[model samples]
Target: MVHVYTGDTMIETTEEHPFWVEEKGWVLAGELNEGDVLRLKSGENVKVTKLERVDLKEPVKVYNFEVQDWHTYYVSDINVLVHNKAARYNTPTPVNPKRVDTNYLKKNGIDPHSLKYDTLGDGADISKYNIYVDKNGELWILKNGSKEFIPTYESIGR
Candidate 1:
């Protein structure tokens, strides 16, 4: 068993247990490291503080359940949300860009296939352009390097 101390709250579970993350989504406790961030009940981001292994003299029994509607629920006692066993270590599935989505990128002179992708990084640092689409579908160019690239943005939608 592993005791995860993250963002003032802690959870005790197997290394295979998955924890909900903000930008990266579900990640296994074993894969989690200090300096990584997790999400709280209030939708706030919290940094992972530490992790410890438990030496058990006897077996520790744990319970399991099925949540058909939402596979995730909050541990109110610890004030943190966790995904059910069914979603253990679940990562975002790669989806081929839609025709319109691809066309939109191509229209902006971005080669859709040229974009690098790594689920482990969760769509981060994939593009040399440093561009991302906001919730409102607005394209934002984040500042990079020595801050020579002035941050700029434009409204876009599918």
Candidate 2:
């Protein structure tokens, strides 16, 4: 964690290192408060200049990255239909054709339904999946097979 001195008070950076830009708005993480601390990769401690809760109603372009920004949504707020280590054929029957609506997941080359495991084409292991939340409040659908983030967003019905 990096420390930033603002006049007299020294603040400790928060858990997630999220960056915010005014023109593009907050991109990496969730809403930030005034006193919240952030540490940039450059080792500079940044304090939130303003308070904002981002709502990713649609896709927005920020920092040359076309990313989804969610302001009003929280991970817990979304009812995750499935989770770790469950048998695919048992319930929720992993939707085929992989109709996901996320951008980051698609970029990482993950096919949730037709997901291949062990190169034997032996379906996929549900235990290998993980969920991650970005600074922009966007949720990630990831497979543990690779170290990269998936860029596809499957359509999770409302």
Candidate 3:
């Protein structure tokens, strides 16, 4: 998922990557038009607009190792496998919460060890982002001015 920081808020979009033979099953980030539909790394199809505006300028932040080896260790085969597992680890299967959510595990009961928080770094400003966990057990980093990106469990407690 790629997000554009448009002064006030962020705009999100789902853009498909051109096929690459190196690694399979990754989504490349790029500009997202208004009505584009693409398959997520989770194998589920999502259409843009659950949150708000879609940005057409920001580059798609591709998380696949096959596309770009931004992370040095991720270039390895073993690391790729580990990353693949991490990507799906503890990820929610159902998209969102419906009536009578059985997964209400209580924020107070959530052990600090179980729930991890990472600072966006010193120079990075995420003030416009509203952080929230959905009823489906997915952690969302939403741009207050826009919409939510597909939540991934990869960065949690790592």
Candidate 4:
């Protein structure tokens, strides 16, 4: 039996929540009321003998990663950037901008070296396969044969 603390209130349960177990790397008691037995990882069974309420000085915090400024391209719209005349007609899966490397851009008919950077200035290089948002908030790309701004869903839907 192990003592599982849920906030300031202690309860006994058979197993701690999987999230708490993975995060703390310890067998914490989770969601027990009265008279519960918990089995430990070592196969030893423990019973909840007592429960007590204690005040916590601070609230617990959980952290998770969030991506910012990420761009996604749809299958139908890929033809605008892909250079291969044959593949241009085929529907491709949605792709992240970062996954498009310099070699892939060249195969798709884009001359990375000759493309002009948008507002990002000199630091922005076409070889990196970067997609940019223009002043009008539309997605734009520069390829070997085309010099037009591509309309994104946001612009087209409206």
Candidate 5:
């Protein structure tokens, strides 16, 4: 049986289902482990009495970006057994271009300077080019001061 911890009460479930615990937040029923403590919705503590691991019908593969190679480690998302040629360690690390240094950007053929933009006095023409860095650190080229952004890589060579 699976138990769900509500803030003020504990409910026993005959089958696996989504469970919410105050301390651990929302989690799938299959993720629960024996001896795990949870706070009920009423702020009472309860321990998981039983847990069973469920085997997935099909295993899933995950991949991370390779900064040195400037591409994903795996050729396809489904191929998880293939090892990354350039990875130095077993731990997975993903590369985000926005967080990289200017030199790194240049090494990857991205010009950090191209991302700079100046205010062209208010009410600028829609066809004007505006280069700016987004919150995620990716560079974008905005045209006509519109919400649509063209990725830096797409416009870099041209």
Candidate 6:
């Protein structure tokens, strides 16, 4: 952990390490957050262990190297894989921002249908097409295998 002096007291923080998430790609150690899913070199998604900052002291040497045909590498002896900030096109990996509508669910018959929940507690997982109210009271429909506020849904039938 890195120690920083903030005027009078020292604060501990995790070092800014690089990570390559398959969904978003090249996220900072701090930006990874507590519950964000981290991507593995083996094409698997896993949760991060910790995101606190740690100092490596003064006169730190940084290395910059690349493995041909790949944008990720191992940083520690324990095989802590890290991803570069940019992909082949000088951009992060792209995620197809798809919006699967309720019609799709009905046509496919994705059951245990929990889309029309009666109460907040009865809502299905956020990854599904479950409606939820935010602290600000805005309604949202989260798509399957997703964790974002998928805006818009046909008004609930009476």
TM-score of each: 0.55, 0.20, 0.28, 0.21, 0.24, 0.38
- Give candidate 3's root-mean-square deviation (CA, Å): 14.2
Best by TM-score: 1
Cα lDDT of model 1 by residue, 42-101, tens digit: 545567898888889998788887654334556646456566763436553322211235
Return the clash pairs for model 4, or none.
Answer: 1-46, 1-47, 4-29, 83-108
| lDDT by residue (tens digit), candidate 4, 31-138 | 334344433323233344455444447754432222222221111211111111221222222233222345754664543343333211233344533443444433
User: Roughly what TM-score does model 3 have, to 2 decimal places?
Assistant: 0.28
The superposed Cα distance between candidate 1 and the true structure at residue 16, in angstroms, equals: 1.3
Cα lDDT of model 3 by residue, 40-157, tens digit: 2222333433333455576655454431211111221111111222233232343552321114324334322222222121222445444455455545444446443423232222
The true-versus-predicted C-alpha distance at residue 2 of model 6, in Å, is 7.3
Candidate 3 lDDT score at position 43: 26
Ranking by lDDT: 1, 6, 5, 2, 3, 4
Off by over 4 Å in 1: 76-78, 86-88, 97-158
lDDT of each: 0.54, 0.33, 0.32, 0.30, 0.37, 0.40
What C-alpha lDDT does candidate 5 achieve relative to the native structure?
A: 0.37
Candidate 3 Cα deviation (angstroms), residue 12: 27
lDDT of 5 by residue, 86-118 (tens): 222122222232333557557657644433221
Q: Model 4 segments beyond 4 Å from truth?
A: 1-30, 62-158
| lDDT per residue (tens digit) for residues 25-110 in model 6 | 34555555554564333433455544446545675665556554334454432233454432231222223333445575455443
* Candidate number that wins on TM-score, 1 or 4: 1
Question: Best lDDT goes to which candidate?
Answer: 1
Predicted candidate 2 versus true structure: per-residue lDDT over 89-121, tens digit per residue = 121212222323336445655343333221111
Name the better of 1 and 6 by TM-score.
1
After superposition on all C-alphas, the RMSD of every candidate to the true structure, in Å, is 11.2, 16.2, 14.2, 21.0, 17.1, 14.3
Instruction: Give candidate 5 misplaced runs (Cα > 4 Å).
Output: 1-16, 52-158
Candidate 6 Cα misplacement greater than 4 A, ranges? 1-17, 74-81, 85-158
